[model samples]
Target: MISVYIGMGSNLDGPVAQLEQAILTLTNHTELHNIAVSPIYSSKPVGPQDQPDYANAVMRLDTKLSAIALLDLLQSVEQEQRRVRDRHWGPRTLDLDILLYGDELIDTPRLSVPHPYMLERGFVIQPLNDLSPELMLANGRRVQEHLSQLDTSDLVIIKEV
Candidate 1:
């Protein structure tokens, strides 16, 4: 099994409930095991501040599925949660992203490992640090190191997992 970190977020249709149900869906997946979830954090929306703040967390999973397959599974969960991708970084019911896949560096049309902007986003870094402070990204920076550099003034821990 390979270790994978997934970032979860929602800002619509009850963000907390959306995240909780998504976690259940991931934990119940047949190919995913040894699930670990971080505390949920509330943060300002990344774009279009008109929307509600987002509830976000990071999840760790040991899985037998390939990276693309895992991405597919995540997308399915989002769809089940009624995710609508009508606008970039717009509010949604769910957003599941593969933040890291072990130590692998992947950049394909369908996915990008290390999540492209995990280091720069406090929403991703804060909860990620809660789960694995020592985790080294594919780019070699430690999770806590990234957390320390980010301005988390807009983040608030809403719930502990």
Candidate 2:
């Protein structure tokens, strides 16, 4: 099984409930195992501050599915949760993204592994650090080291769960 990480968030009703349900959904999948979850963090919306802040967390899973397949699974989960993608970075009921897949770097029309924005987004990096502090990036640096190099002042951990 390949070790993979997923970032999950929701700003709508019962955000924590949505996250918990999503985690259960992924674990129920026959292809995923060894599931692990990070403590949930409440964060301010990244793009449009007008919307409600979000509850976010990272999940680690050992999966037998390929990258594209895993992406498909996440999309299905979003759809099942009624996530609307009417606008870019808009508010949603659920959002999931591929953060990392083993040490493989991929760039394809359909998908990209080691999510392109992983390093740039504090929301993603912070929760990831909580889940795996010493986790190494494909480039050979630890996640906490990368997080230290970032400015997460705008991203507040309003609560922990």
Candidate 3:
């Protein structure tokens, strides 16, 4: 089984509920199991701050599916949750991004493993640290180390949600 970390977020239509449903959806998939989720965080929108803030979190899944298959599953989940690609960084009902897949580094037209922006986004980094501080990347960098390199002072965890 390959270990994959996914970042989930939403800004529209009860973000927290959507995230919970997404997790349930993942767990219901037979090929995926042992899902570990980080605490939910409220983050300021990345691209356009004018948009509603997003509730974000990370999930670690042990799955028998290949990277491409996992990507397909994620897309299907987004569609099930009514995610629309209206604009770049636009508001959506759900956003599921594969942050990392085992120790693999992949660059493909359909999907990129070890997500291209995993290290750069505080939303991704903070939850990653929460889930597994000692988790190491393919490049031998720890989750806590990457989080330390980021400015996450503005990121706030929403414990109640």
Q: Of the candidates shown, which would achieve the greatest lDDT relative to the real structure?
A: 1
- Candidates 2 and 3 compared: the better one by lDDT is 3
User: In candidate 2, how many Å is residue 102 off?
Assistant: 0.7
- Candidate 3 residue pairs in clash (backbone atoms < 3 Å): none
The TM-score obtained by model 3 is 0.96
Q: What is the lDDT of candidate 2?
A: 0.88
The Cα error of candidate 2 at residue 121, in Å, is 1.8
Worst 10 residues of 1 by lDDT: 134-143
**How many pairs in model 2 have backbone atoms within 3 A of each other, for residues 3 or more apart or on separate chains, i.e. clashes?**
0
Q: What's the TM-score of every candidate structure?
A: 0.97, 0.92, 0.96
Tens digits of per-residue lDDT for model 1, 30-53? 899999999999999987988999
What pairs collide in candidate 1?
none
User: What digit string (tens of lDDT, one per residue) describes model 2 on residues 86-128?
Assistant: 7788889999999999988889997888898889878889989
Which window of 10 residues has the lowest lDDT sum in candidate 2?
Answer: 152-161
Clashing pairs in 2: none
**Over all chains combined, what TM-score does candidate 2 have?**
0.92
Provide the lDDT at 131 for model 1: 86
Off by over 4 Å in 1: none
